[model samples]
Target: MIPGMGAVATTFVAGVEAVRKGFATPIGSLTQMGTVRLGRRTESRAPKVNEFVPLAGLNDLVFTGWDIFEDDMYAAASNAGVLERALLDQVKPFLSSIQPRKAVFDHNYVKRLDGPNVKKGKNKMDLVEQVRQDIRDFKKSSGASRLVMIWCGSTETFIEQGPAHQSVKAFEKALTQNDESIAPSMIYAYASLSEGVPFGNGAPNLTVDVPAMHELSRRNEAPICGKDFKTGQTLIKTILAPGFKARLLGLSGWYSTNILGNRDGEVLDDPGSFKTKEESKLGVLEHILQPRLYPELYGNIFHKVRINYYPPRG
Candidate 1:
């Protein structure tokens, strides 16, 4: 479930539906109909991931989510304004069917948004209860026994580690106390863990990666992984950086820039959010370069990422 099913989510869902309907191919994602090499040139064999593994069937999988706006997925996709008209028209019915539940939102998390479809409560815990109700209702309504929530939502403010996020017990107490450290994404994470559902943070919110959420996941016998699901440009970086390390490429400078008109680009327009993404970008070097190990080669490498949220040219 994409909590905020905008462009990426709609594209993913529409692409999947189109593939299911024999109208298009799953072009980008590796999970759907992706092939893997077997052994060697001698073997000359490769197999689709689905064929190789006992993966859950796509027909059996269900998608449901939350959004701050009341717009259905089709409308959200249209608003995101990413995909072409022909493609959206082709998948309108499928997109329309996947209406989002009212969002578990915090305006403090995303300052630019103000929508009518938001859920409200006296405190963060009440917000959690509403989201839990949403999960329960979605499961019941959709008749889906298995559920996974991926937070494809907007980035919240920068939250530093604090006592409120130290442990599950402490975090729960903070939720009741309305601690400022309890950001919106953290509230959603708490809800998912409480419901015995696995959660993934698609945005760079560090939602499930927090010590509190990680502890909650372990305690609940659920799995959680995030910081982000790298998309677009970052995917390229992951590949090239690894190859650079493998080939011993002396990297003097690496500058990454992107210009696009989309919700993603718009969200990152904020300095705080740009900082969120910029940090995620910086993390690549810290992990890939191993500053402790390669202080000589990577210490001086000037890497900068710039993304301008330009409106669509058309």
Candidate 2:
């Protein structure tokens, strides 16, 4: 299951269908293509990761997601333009079979994006219940014995952990009170954890990274991981920064900029959403370089991240 069936979600579903049909290989997927070495190096006991462990095959996967727009996966993929028309046509029937459900959304959280397909509820807790119901309904209808939720939602407005996020009790109370700090992503995380479903956050929102969520995850035995997907620029930074630090290189400044016209780019055009992404991106270097330990090499370095919404580029 997923929230926000936008370009990322559509492309993923389409790609998986394409791979399952033998149209392409699952390149770069560790579970599918990676190898693991076991025992002693002299043993030469390297095996495919999937063979080394019992993992779900591509055919075993099912798809469903929530989106503010009501488009089915085929239409959504067509709009995204990430995949070629010819490729999408090959998986058209499979893609067309998957349709997005109404999403729990808030215009205040994502200032630049809104759609007709949104859940209506009296309060935040009500929304959580609605999401829980959606999870249950999907599980029964899809006949998925086991389930996992990955949040592919847009970046919400920047927010810090607050009183409402301190405990499950406080969070539940805040939900009833319709607390502004409780963004839509948090509602989904709370609902998924409550249902004992693993939740993976793919956006830089304060979704699962909270005390209340941590407590719920421990109590329910549901794993949760978050804040963003290190794809593109951040992926490169993670790879390069560690090498630079290992070699004891000094950094002066790093200015990163991106321009795109996808829904992600448009959503990030809003400063509130951009601030959330900025925080996630800026922390990468500090975490790897450890400015406190290497003050001389990293403390005074300047880092700037800029994202421009260029409609023509899409």
Candidate 3:
């Protein structure tokens, strides 16, 4: 299940449905279109990833998720305007039937956005329990063998690991006491890991990056990964930066700026929220360039990232 049924999540669901109905192809999805090469290069044993691996087909896959807004998937996708009306209309029956459950959200974490469709609890622990119940109910109703949670939620305010996030015991105490460091995203991660559900973080929130969450993942044998999905400019940076580093090219400065008018852009307008995204985006160059190894060429290089919110431009 997805945590945030916003533009990205709804667009993905609608795209999958369109592909299932033969209206369109899964052009950009690696799982659907990518091929895996088996054995030596001379061997012509390559096959499509779906055919090579024991993966579920598009027709068998199910979608359900939570969102801060009360809109169903169809309405959400329409409001997002990411996909054309004609395309979304073709999958209206399927998309309209998938309604989002109330999400666990907090204004402190994402200051620029708020909605009434949110979970209310006495404490963070209570919120986690409610999410756990939602997972159980969805599983029983869907009759799926296994489940995975992908955090397609908004970026939360920048937060550092505190004493509360050091261990599972400390985390539980903090959750019960409603600690400020525990964001709503963390609550969902904790709940999913506790129930043995593998979780993925699409946004750059410190949702599954802390020691307590890692410990829980290990204990439960639930695989977990991600702080960012790394697309757009960052993807290019990952592809090109290594070339410059390998050639030992000197780099003095790098400036990256963006103008996103989506819901993500609105949420990132707040400085606290921007800091979270900045941390994730800024780390790429440092790690890729490895200034320690190439001090003369990469050390002391300047890097900047600015994300401007342009509502009409998304």
Candidate 4:
């Protein structure tokens, strides 16, 4: 399922709908058109991934989600700033029909975001129960045998690991005590895991990646992965930085910035949220270079990532 169906999700939905209607091809996705290689390279034995696996067809995917805002999927997708107007227009009707259910949110975690279509509860634990109800309702209404929860929401502020993140039991206790470490993403994760749905995290926030959440995922037998995306400029940095490492060159300091005029940029202006993203982006360097093993060549370097929000004309 696609949560926080803003730009990425909406564009994806519109494109998928367009493809299903035979309007265009599914670009930027390997599974749709990419070929897999087997045996010797000279043998020319590359087969499509679909032919090899018992994967469900694209038509089988039924999208659903909970958004803090009440915008229909089309409107949300339009505002997400990832797709062209003409493309969104093509799938407007399909997008309009998919409205978001009330999301389970707490402003404390995501200070920059606020939504009217959200569940209300006196305590954090109560909010968990409400999310569980939403899951049950969505499943019965859609009649989908399997479900997945993907977090595409704005990044929450940085939260350090605490006792609540130790295990599911301690985590629930933290929920009962309204633990500060327990961010809103954890609530969605807890609910999704409780219902046996696989949760995909697209944000840099410490949602399903934490120990408590990871434990819950294994207990529930669901898969999860993410820490921001290696897309756009970040994806480029990943490639360039690796080349520097291959030649034994040190990156004393590397500066990068994105001039984006969108809700995402506005939300990231807050340092707390930006720091969460910054740290996630920072790991790519040392992880790629193994700086710890080579302290003399690549240690104590500064890596700065910046984003400036701007307003643009229609």
In order of appearance, the predictions have TM-scores of 0.93, 0.98, 0.98, 0.94
Q: What is the C-alpha RMSD of each candidate to the true structure, in Å?
A: 1.8, 1.1, 1.1, 1.7
Which candidate, 2 or 4, has the higher lDDT?
A: 2
Question: Candidate 4's residue-wise lDDT over 22-57, tens digit each?
Answer: 888987778888888999999999988888777778
lDDT of 1 by residue, 204-286 (tens): 87576668888889888878877777876787788888888877666788889878576777777878777878888878866
Tell me the spans in candidate 3 whose CA falls farther than 4 Å from its real position: none
**Model 3, residue 301: displacement in angstroms?**
1.0
1 against 2, candidate with superior lDDT: 2
- What lDDT score belongs to each candidate, Candidate 1 first? 0.80, 0.92, 0.92, 0.81
Q: What TM-score number comes out for model 4?
A: 0.94
For all candidates, the clash counts are: 0, 0, 0, 1
lDDT of 2 by residue, 1-314 (tens): 99988889988888899999999888778888999999999999999998989988889999999999989999988888888899999999998998888999999999999899999999999999999999999999989989999999899999999999999999999999999999999999999999999999999999889999999999999999877887877888999999999999999998988776778989999999999999999999999999899999998999999999987432
Clash pairs, candidate 1, are none
lDDT of 1: 0.80
* Candidate 3 colliding pairs: none
> Local error of candidate 3 at 119, Å?
0.8
lDDT, candidate 4, at 38:
96
> What lDDT does candidate 1 reach at residue 154?
81
